[model samples]
Target: MFERFTKPARAAVVQSQVEARRLGHDRIDDSHLLLGVLAQEAGVGARVLTELGVGLDAARDAVAALHAPDAQALGALGIDLDEVRRKAEAAFGEGALERRFARRRGFFRRSTGHIAFTRPAKAALEDALRQALTLRHNYIGTEHLVLGLLTGGSSTAGRVLHRLGVRVDAAELRRRVLDELGRAA
Candidate 1:
């Protein structure tokens, strides 16, 4: 399922798997993949996601919704929830978030053919993943990616978010969700 990815995209997938394992997770969920992409810091997908308002917490919510069990009381609704998830996954894969940044960065490299993400971008991606895991989310989504871009701060993605007016506060959103869950419980 992952063969269509380029070298950097493949790296993102590998990074996502590593992150999932580090977090003791067993599956390569979308959120984990999102985190993996962001880990590259300079990938086209991460930059595009950051440009959008999506962040780690919002991504978590979306993924959590996907993970939520179907309501037994909604039997009459007759909705194919699995199909919905599959569609969402397909959409995510087709989006700009799945592209590699390595090719983009390669344009500026010296003759040695060595290029790396700026430090801030790398940190931003790591922070995004940490924030997502801290919230106990099983999958990485667009939001986490946005948060990583913001946290990575001062990159093209971060600048794009500022231009788009997306807030970069993952913790606040997490707290609010927890509060809501507490109330529901």
Candidate 2:
């Protein structure tokens, strides 16, 4: 299946891993996949999403906002999240929490080479293949990936898109993609 990916598609996949790592995630999820597609500024997927007002930086900020600690919820437990972060950073320097997991134990040891995909992410990839097949395409491209992310119901990407004000459904996004393809052709 990977062999069927075009260069753009493969780059998106790689970019997803880079996003996951940047966000300190143990696995890549649909949100990361969305980021991957959006990172491709020239890809049809990115162009369609941008037209819908979802750009890469904004999407990344949304994803980070979603994963950030719930200060309001923590307040109910009498915890001051901001104070804790400030104190921790002051005590150990900035990015102290991040350094804990990212630190290398030995001179030769480093972070793992691979980060696995979450179930939903794997499902999205599977759906990308299905999308390509549905479109009668010989290979999976970045556009198919965007379609898969949109159709992966209740996915993190869906939530991120919602936050980014992308109200279009999968069908709508698909139409836009086709239109873009037609223009390119």
Task: Give the residue spans of candidate 1 off by over 4 A.
Answer: 1-114, 138-143, 152-156, 164-185
* Per-residue lDDT of model 1, residues 1-185, tens digit only: 22323566568757756654544344444455555665665555555554445554454344444434675534458766556556867876543322323334547322222223345545655665665576575544334444554554355444433444556464554454344435544
* Root-mean-square deviation of candidate 1: 17.1
| Tens-place lDDT digits, model 2, residues 31-55 | 9999999998888888888889998
C-alpha lDDT score of every prediction, in listed order? 0.50, 0.89
Superposed Cα deviation of residue 94, candidate 2 (Å): 4.8
- The estimated TM-scores of all candidates read 0.32, 0.88
Query: Residue 22 of model 2: what lDDT?
Result: 94
- The residue pairs in collision within model 2 are none
**Considering every candidate listed, which one attains the maximal lDDT?**
2
